[model samples]
Target: MRRLIGAAVVGLGIELVVLPLWLLPRSPAWGLLLIPLTLLTTPFWSLLHEAIHGSLVRDRRANDAWGRVLAIGYGAPFALLKSGHLLHHRYSRTERERTEIYATGRWASHAPGYYLRLFGGLYLAEVASVLLALLPERGWAALVRRTDRPDTITGLLFDRVRRRFLTQFRLDASAVVAVHLAAFLAYGRYGWMLVAALAGRGLLISLADNAYHYGTRLDASLEALNLRLPRPLETFVLAFNLHSVHHRHPGLPWHELRTAFAADGDEFHDDWFAAVGKQLRGPLPAGTLIASSPGVRRH
Candidate 1:
């Protein structure tokens, strides 16, 4: 409950603080303030992630409702994301499924360019996902059939899992549109800052997410890279820094993750920036990081 309140407060602060600061009559100081304010939205995205996993709340209906609201703030459809995310959990680290969670195409495996694309166009990737979700079911189906690929999030958005929750999808879409329209009206000429904030959110989200499982091999145990982050960030993102624990015990609530990790700490990686730095340099050693964990041999 306290974590939820913190997320709500920061999410609201993004609108109240960042938007107005960006709109304030041209000033270098206000521009500087916008940087951290925009980046501060990372936890809000984390809340959306918790909701997508259905671990944010105990009640199913309430969880889905909050998922929709958070998705609107992230500018993605809740139903679409929830569907893709379930598939991701089922097929993590595989060529066919990891793309749903991270942009792991051929280019993403190569040198410094991978990090460039990961951070530089993370928001554009979200925009593409939104556009894909907007396609009619049949239209999206046709596109998938033409490509003969089900590896990307855009392709996964065409999955049939969402058919059962079509109404929720529409509601999520409507909420996103309404939120954007309201922001536009409120910011007027400087409404573009809202769009910039969305991009900023995407960059931070991808950085944090990539830090989790970016360089793992397909056959790795648990298939996750748990980094050691600062105490404040770890608390703020609700222990997502311990990515392996969350993936291993997906049913655990955010607050419970730390206790769970303490019991099976050997199975997780805590190499700090090792994985991210290795991936940034070039291709990563498959499962090498995970192999270092006690009793967890690399496949």
Candidate 2:
């Protein structure tokens, strides 16, 4: 209940108040709010992530209901985010999931894509994916079939997409589009502000998303960096900085991740900000790093 309420307050506050205030003619002062507002997305996404893992609330149905609500405000469909996240756990560090890896001698070719994903491209892709919902059932299925590979992310998502799932996905996706469209319309002449805010949110999310897993061992599904942060800051982010601990104990709620990390006697691989910075070094050849490689430690 607290998580749901907090998410609602923060999500609605941004949508209803902060954004609209920015559009006022004399709202230059309102621009200051954008910094904290953008930063809030970190914890906002953490809350949605909790719902995704069924830890936001004990009641599964209620949890999912709140998750869809939060996800809609976050600018994507809950089902799509949930599927992709679960698949990340299932396929982490595999070729299908290694965002920071490239084939030998392909670094130059892969660098642009890697940098794009590092910035804001990942979230933009998620927002754009709502277009799939517009397709007819057969068209959606055919597209998925053409793109799906058993070892790939598309395959992972497609494998879980039944008729009922598709119906729900489409409904949730339509809701997402509707909500954002309404926001855009409300922004009127200041619509560019909404776009800029979303771009900032996307940049923050994309930059942090892969920080924990960047340059980790291939096929090490449970591996991630336990990036360090001060205790207060870590708590502020809902203990999400303890990535390796959460991966090892996915069922543990965010509040319990710190306890799990301490109980496991694990070490932080790098400072949180530093680890995120390391991604800027770009892609490396696969197999260049091992599970316990020094590179992983450095990251």
Each prediction's TM-score versus the true structure: 0.78, 0.92
Off by over 4 Å in 1: 2-10, 13-33, 98-117, 147-154, 271-274, 282-299
* Deviating ranges (above 4 Å) for candidate 2: 1-4, 16-18, 21-28, 162-164, 291-299
lDDT of model 2 at position 245: 92
Model 2, residue 140: distance off in Å is 2.0
Error of 2 at 24 (Å): 2.8
lDDT of 1 by residue, 45-128 (tens): 667778888887878888887777667767778887777667667767665645223333453545454565567455555545
Q: How much is 75 displaced in model 1, in angstroms? A: 1.2
On a 0 to 1 TM-score scale, where does candidate 2 land against the true structure?
0.92
- Clash pairs, candidate 1, are none
* Highest lDDT model number: 2
After superposition of all CA atoms, the RMSD between model 2 and the true structure is 2.4
